[model samples]
Target: MKNIRNFCIIAHIDHGKSTLADRLLEFTKTVQVTGGQMLDNMDLEKERGITIKSHAIQMEHEYKGEKYVLNLIDTPGHVDFSYEVSRSIAACEGALLIVDATQGVQAQTISNLYMAIDHDLEIIPIVNKCDMDSAMPEEVEDEIIDLLGCERSEIIRASGKTGLGVEEILSAVIERVPHPVGDEEAPLQALIFDSVYNTFRGVIAYFKIVNGVLRSGDEVKFFNTGKEYEADEIGVLKMDLSPRKELRTGDVGYIISGIKTSKEVKVGDTITHIDRPCSKAISGFEEVKPMVFAGVYPIDASDFEDLRSSLEKLQLNDASLTFQPESSLALGFGFRCGFLGLLHMEIIQERLDREFDMDVITTVPNVSYRIYDKQGGMTEVHNPGGMPEPTLIERIEEPFISASIITDTSFIGPIMTLCLGKRGELEKQNYISGNRVEIQFKMPLGEIVIDFYDKLKSISKGYASFDYHQDSYRPSKLVKLDILLNGESVDALSTLTHVDNAYDMGRRMCEKLKELIPRQQFDIAIQAAIGAKIIARETIKAVRKDVTAKCYGGDISRKRKLLEKQKKGKKRMKQIGNVEVPQKAFLAVLKLD
Candidate 1:
């Protein structure tokens, strides 16, 4: 049997997971052999400094006369992609738990480590970014030993950015990480951990061989569903940067089983021999669900088709992205999309802009809300634009989330006050990694799912980290504050707010909406209303009269033309009876900025 080592790199966001993968790719001679360039091939990946999706690559390296095929998976760091990270961990026998040398252990690091431990994978702790001026290897090593209970000397210090300790880290993988120990001659069983598309060859299903040899042209069945297909091509990932034929048991390879689309190959599905099919599939595969929702609309209506095509291609690569067509009275046509979290949202948006080159209008993000009615009917609404009438909602509750914030002790007070201000209920407080403190709070899921991360970073000067999960549905006296331009509801100005803050929030919304819309041909009334009550009001002054009653010397036809122009301009005014609305009124209500 070939010596195989499967491992993943885990770290908090911006902690250098991709950089480490690049170094490993270089050291194993995979880049030289395959002629693959640096890892950040996608413009978005390089620009963002984060890995939005989990990616795996293979390398063949000889250590101490032992030839080992190292399968390394680089995982996403944000909490939104935690499910993906967990799956990557499960696909491996060990993981390099990367902790930033200068920043020490962040909350995401701890969360990902726990996930790795839960998967029963061996942990090879690695301290990265040792080249940073603030890096304190001794303190960081001590913290890792104390917090994670790992041997002090076992933590390998490396600068992934500088290619330091790359060879040593690979050697340690051979010594510390266990080789795959499953039988190769038993019923052919393989676990499909990831899948992608090859433009000319169709879907390339990546799987780890568990039992029995799988050669090209063999018939295989997905054990979970008993679906069968003949292998069109079977291959290992070559340094040439693509799949090469003839993969066998115990090796990580791709199966081009005439699976034309990636949709047929799911992560965690078991590929087995048709004649001697395995009796069981791999355990511990969880379906990833999205937690954030937003409305995505094209800047131009003609690009709607382009948007759909782009989304489809993106979904082919990322299974977690979800979307559905939605239209609003304000936004003519758009989509209500669900994502794993904020990072996922940003990634998708960035892809749309960068890859597709499509300009889009995005709505303020909202979490899934639970609607309770007196008639015993219940429903979940992910977009505010989809909310039912107030009369239909006898009682409404929004999802609450449990959030953990890690920061230095000095910022605790400011952070606490901000949380309290946002209606977060304190759960507990504790110290982690010595001087760093973690504060747990129960917050309205909607509050933290939006710009909370950016605001937290701004408040903490980029020193704080936050992560959250849905807790439960809690009763909330909430109202949809709608702003009216003229007499019609300006759909873009609507916001879901607690009843207590309706007046103040409405005023702020109306003021902002007024600023966004341009001065109209006529004066207009911009008012925020809660049922029959007007909570706040603003005005858009009307354009001055264009034509005056005057006698023309010898230009009677010119005067008539001027009068016709004035009439047309008056009709262009957004008016509700005596009120005239400006062009800016509509735009102002739609965007908070």
Candidate 2:
């Protein structure tokens, strides 16, 4: 057990954590050839150049004739998966904090640093991407030392691309990262950090053994569900499966039970032997809940089943992805899906298209609102279509977020402008490094969850990075803005916005919808309103013609008759005309700023 070292790599996106993992695998000879960021084996991951899911693998390395077991866990670098990072840290004894040498500490890097600290894990700071032409190892090293108050000599510099400091990194794991401690003779207890649904093995729970030992014949029970299943198989992941009869304490591996679904074995659940169950379940097991909600509908109503099947397959791997059958009068059969954030929502939508081959349309993402009624009744509404009437609602509470932003000195002005416009409350501002600034703000989740990231990138010219976590709900004056076409409300076009900007947003939405909606045969009314009161309106005129055709020398009577006939035709068309709204029109409202 002293030779076993369990640790994970934490970093901001594109910091070469996966590359470093590949090098570790190569140096340790875990595989014949180098993995080359092969830890990111998902098709979508390779295409997008980002780690979406956290992965774990076991490796064996020897130094001075002593064999060491290094179980390295790779985590997603994006802030959208902070919950995953927390789970990964809980399953290990230490973390390798990777920061880019060129970019220094980013928004997510600081956030991840705090997570590793909160877990009380031994942190090994390593400056990655040292081979880059723009590498500033000294500047980044100073940043790390200042942030963590560690010795300047303690920070390690390495290049994942060139394999520099690879051996030292391995040695650090053996010498610095503490050996995991657990009682092998006690009750079998394992912390499940992740899980997957396998066709042959059913639910394969990826766990780190915390106490006792797990054998193939043992019947295990989930602490949260209180359900028991036989351990059909047990193995460790090293590129591929390495089956074993037993997984002792301090080992990280998978337990194959007949459990067929991902929900059968949750990510943060503890599993123990049925006969010798632990008196108490492992601590630090947190249930990940979704924060962002959006309505996902099949482009073709007939493909709803396919969409559902696709989402199920995805949910098997992604425990945080949630969905329930939702009926939309405007969009037909669909599901109300909950995601961690915008990137998560994006990945799921992309997966449905690539992995499931289902074309789907997603409504504008929204945060859950706490609705209070006149009679003291309270409710939560995620979809604007489900909001209670304005008169019935006494108050509304919107979700707020504590946000952090890191940017170069050159872009501070624009970054602040964009943030304040989003109803942000400045909390703190300071220079983290010589030319880099970190800003903290408290903002309404509704404001930034939509296009705040995009706007920030545009203003900073892609030099700024952002990360935010959900905070406590704050009371706010909110209104549901509805779009009307010829006096009929479009359910999908309904959205919730702060009442202060409702008039301006409504006017802009009305204008954008008018520009996108094709001209109809008759005059169409495009109105944005709150309840029955129209806040903004635009009129789309019908196609008109001179009707007095080939009038060589038209007299007053002839022209008057032609005009009267044209007016009558316009009236007839208005009575029977039904404006055909294009799909793009509904989508245009999403981009209406």
Best by lDDT: 2
Which whole-number lDDT from 0 to 100 does residue 190 have in model 2?
91
Error of 2 at 126 (Å): 1.5
The digit string of per-residue lDDT tens for model 1 on 1-593 reads 54888888898888888888888988877774242225545677666676767877788899878788898888988767787787778778889999889877776787888788888888988999999999998888987897678888899999977889898899988889888778866888888877766668777777888778887888888877567899887777653345455566667778886666445666788998788888788788877767777788887788887887677667766778888888777666878888876778767887888877987776666777788887979988766666788887888888888998988788898899889978999999998766789899999977666656666777776667777767889989988877777768756446687888788778877787666666766667788998777989989776676474664476678888887887676666444344323434433343342
By summed lDDT, the worst window of 10 consecutive residues in model 2 runs over 583-592
Each candidate's clash count:
12, 0
In candidate 2, stretches whose alpha carbon ends up further than 4 angstroms from where it belongs are 32-36, 300-309, 401-416, 427-442, 456-475, 514-525, 537-588, 591-593
Q: Highest TM-score among the candidates is held by which one? A: 2
Off by over 4 Å in 1: 32-37, 223-226, 239-241, 298-309, 332-334, 356-360, 406-408, 460-467, 518-525, 539-568, 575-593
| TM-scores vs. true structure, each candidate | 0.86, 0.87
Q: Write the per-residue lDDT of candidate 2 for residues 74-161, one digit (tens) a residue.
A: 9998767777788889988899999899988776777777878888889999999898999999988988887888998778889988
Lowest summed lDDT across 10 adjacent residues in model 1 is found at 579-588
